[model samples]
Target chain A: MSFVSYLLNGISLGSVYAIIALGYTMVYGIAKMLNFAHGDVIMIGSYVAFVAINSMGLPIPVAILLSVAACTLLGVTIERVAYKPLRHASKLAVLITAIGASYFLQNVALLIFGANTKSFSSVVKMQPIQLAGGQLNITGETIVTVAACIVIMICLMAFMKYSKAGHAMLAVSEDGGAAQLMGINVNGTIALTFAIGSALAAIAGVLLCSAYPSLTPYTGAMPGIKAFVAAVFGGIGSIPGAFIGGILLGVIEILGKAYISSQLADAIVFAVLIIVLVVKPTGLLGKQIQEKV
Target chain B: MKKLSKTTKSSLITYGIVVFAYIFCEIFMRTGHMSSLLKGILVPLCVYVVLAVSLNLTVGILGELSLGHAGFMCVGAFASAVFSKCMMETITVPTLRFALALLVGVVCAGVCGVLIGIPVLRLRGDYLAIVTLAFGEIIKNLVNVIYLGVDSNGFHVSMKDAMSLQMEPDGLVIIKGAQGITGAPTDSNFTIGVVLVLITLVVVTNLVHSRTGRAIMAIRDNRIAAESIGINITKYKILAFSISAALAGAAGVLYAHNLSTLTALPKNFGYNMSIMILVFVVLGGIGSIRGSMIAAVVLTLLPELLRSLNEYRMLIYAVVLIATMIFTWSPSAIGFRERYSPAKLFHKREKGVQ
Candidate 1:
């Protein structure tokens, strides 16, 4: 593949990771709990899409909306059920709960849907776009998918940066107690954070399904880790940083496929993550804050 | 909690596990058909106890959530399989082969544990979780690619005629390509597994009760405070990790020998196993050794009990796990704190209480 092709692929794939990552980073930023189930939210989103498309027989647009809606609701359900009760528990317990939720989701998906891989049939695959050279050929699905991700991400970023709800989220994430004292409903902001992250995960599921049609119960597993890595790479709590990190990670992974042994490709991505963590745990855009003794 | 000598407590748990195993085997014989199913459940139960306890050392005791025990188990499984296969020709005794295989597996896993532990020791909090998760994927992926076949087909003896077998000294039998190692002696019995699990429980319990274990739990409670008091955080983390790895290695051997069919699949040792084992530790309550064993057995038996649910087994598990997580998490639930807590149990009450 050409460098441009690699870059395009990286940015597109990375955006999906960034979308999934935003959920992880924001939750971690606010709660200091690793939501292992966040990855499974993407899995759940794909299933919601499966239900909307297969069972409901809704229009593609309606199906996407339904998936996103279901994901948002489920996100809140998780917070309420798994997280809300554990707020006062040791942070490790919350983390363990998240893992339990993650395993629970994947297993449930397996039992309900069967372990066989499902493919989302597409009418968009036939239309292939020809680039300037014969060397590069992009499909219609890829184009729409990438473009949709960029637009959704921009909207999400805007919502976080300017909206009152977003500012409240920022305040609560910074200091939940202080934010509560300042008349901000910290719990409400957290629920909103989950909602936004979940909605993005649903979008990511749709895009991933389009790019790679097969959807397994565990499909979100790898991307979950990679996106979190991306989030960490850019700065765990930073939205734009997640975007940049995701794209950069995607590009590196793809380019490594060509320049390095593909067998070690995944390892290299994580190796870089470790190196980055060792050098700067707070990440590029994140400022270091000393934990209060 | 009353105080008992470490050696005595260890012996008690060990003997208790052995007696429990005999009774369990009696129940298995009483359950009638589907003996394989019973064995399957028993095997994983025994194995998972070790895995959960080993993982608890890191996630529970060491104050780091490392999701890589499955990776170490993978190392153990492969190492055990290789060791047994290599010894197949030289060691004709089936039982001895099994014993040696497990021994080799545990050692290999322990070495790998230490190797991986070095860099990860520096990490703490969720950063440790992410790094361990990454390391797990790396190990699994690497194993998926690396394989060495058994040189059983008479060593090809100068690559004789293309269509012919190279005989002369020995018979032709070849280890297949990434086809999975098969036909190992059925060396893993329920008794062996229970013994190992019991041994692991005792060893781990003793370690946890030891000064080292207390130091680990203290670190888990408050890293800075523990460090301030002169606890070598990284050293204890590594020690706990290596022990965890060794236990997981022993479990891997059990899994490999009992299952017979072995393949290098990353997916097998993937995040799900890690998470499942962690749930066992969490559900049982971290820092509680007996709790770890109980949770492991319960979670292990749960899927079996739900077998009647057929396809709904996992859905039921999800419900059960979620419900239990909620139940344990609720502040009103008294023992819930005891079950899921990773903190040190000791408390220095106020002067007025005395």
Candidate 2:
């Protein structure tokens, strides 16, 4: 592939990461907890889509809808069951519970699906567009993933800005106690945040699997972690930061693999994280807050 | 006077648990009445015990969450494995070689601990967690790329491939790229593992009771106050973290020597392994040494005991994990524990007798 195609690949991959990071940032913004299980929700969405399309013989669109709806429900249920009780608990406790929920989701997928990688047919079937005298080609999947990510970002921004529910989410995220006092049902907004995040996870899952073309119980794990790193890199809880962070991480990862040693790509990526963290803990675009006594 | 007696009482109980474990393993081994599966897990159970206890030093005592203990273990495993491989011809005695290798592993891992702790410990909370996690990943990845071999001509290092190892015809390959160390001596046994566990317990419990330990806990409980009280925060944090790393390295040596073929697969020393260790620490109740030990041994053996359940084993493990966290940390569970705790009953009995 030419340099252009490689950059395109990175853009496509980064867009998928951005979608996943949105879930993380949304949940973190609203709940003040890292939804570690959010990654596994991607896995769940992919599996649900797989079953709907391949096993149940449903159309691709219906399968996509099923995946999104299932993930939305799963996300809400997880928040209610595992996270709700621990809302007032220690951060460490909530973090561990999130880890537990992540573990639970992965293992349940393993139990149901077994520890095997499943081949997933491309959701978006279109001819690859040849460019630069056939030197550069972009697949339909890549186009769809990138386009859909942009659309989602726009929709999310508009929703957060204009929608009443979105405004409620913003209020809850700012201060749950204050929002509750303002008669904005804190739990409901939090639940809505999870639903929206998980629904995005479904889109990300399908797009990611389409690009990668393989699905395992752990397919979401590395991407999940990388997306989280992206979120952190962009400054956690900032939507645009997540967007830019995801793209930048993706480009760096792709370019590192293309130029540097493939084995060292993950290390290089993490090394960048260390450097960023050491230099600026709040990450790019993150606001600084004074430490309170 | 009561406090002194209470310290003795707790130490006595700690020793009692160790003795009980040793005897139980001994009886199982000598009797041979139990399944081979039980015997097989003894060494691993002990390794997990050491790992859990040492991790408790950072997570529980230091009040910093480190998700990179496995990375330290990985460092120790490879360092010790390389040492043993290099000394294979020179040192004929397996026992002596294993002991020397263990020392080497501890030093290497402890050095890694200090190196990682210095820069990473400056950050706190989630940032610290992710950075340490990154450090762990970096170490794991570096080990995979790093190739070390030993021959009569001495050690040859390479990064690209094994063919870069231009050594004498009989040069022993020690860390092949991704393939890891092979033909390693399996010197780990139930007895040695138990001894390591005891050593870990002694070190950790002593540290927890010492003045340094008090300062460390104080830092964990309230860093600002600890700093105000003139505790050298960085010194104590690094001291606790490196010690924890050193202990994890010791566990790594035990684990590396236990297996004939030690591969640096992500499964062995990756994020998953790190998370699992954290789970042991968290589920055992943060900062509770004995709790970590019990949780480690039980959780390790739980899957093995449930082997007959096959697919249900991990499912059950997940349920138990979530349930344990809920019960241990949930508000309702706190209420339950406060009412029915054995320690409370013991305190009541002592008061009555007085």
For candidate 2, list the clashing residue pairs, or say none: none
List DockQ for all candidates. Answer: 0.51, 0.72
Docking class of 2: medium
Evaluate model 1 with DockQ and give the value. Answer: 0.51
RMSD to the native, candidate 1? Answer: 5.6
TM-score, model 2 to reference: 0.95
**Which stretches in model 1 have alpha-carbon errors above 4 Å?**
A1-3, A50-57, A107-116, A123-128, A258-264, B1-14, B24-34, B150-178, B332-354
lDDT of 1 at B69: 79
Number of the top-ranking candidate, with TM-score as the measure? 2
Clash list (residue pairs), candidate 1: B285-B339
Candidate 1 at B281: error in angstroms? 0.3
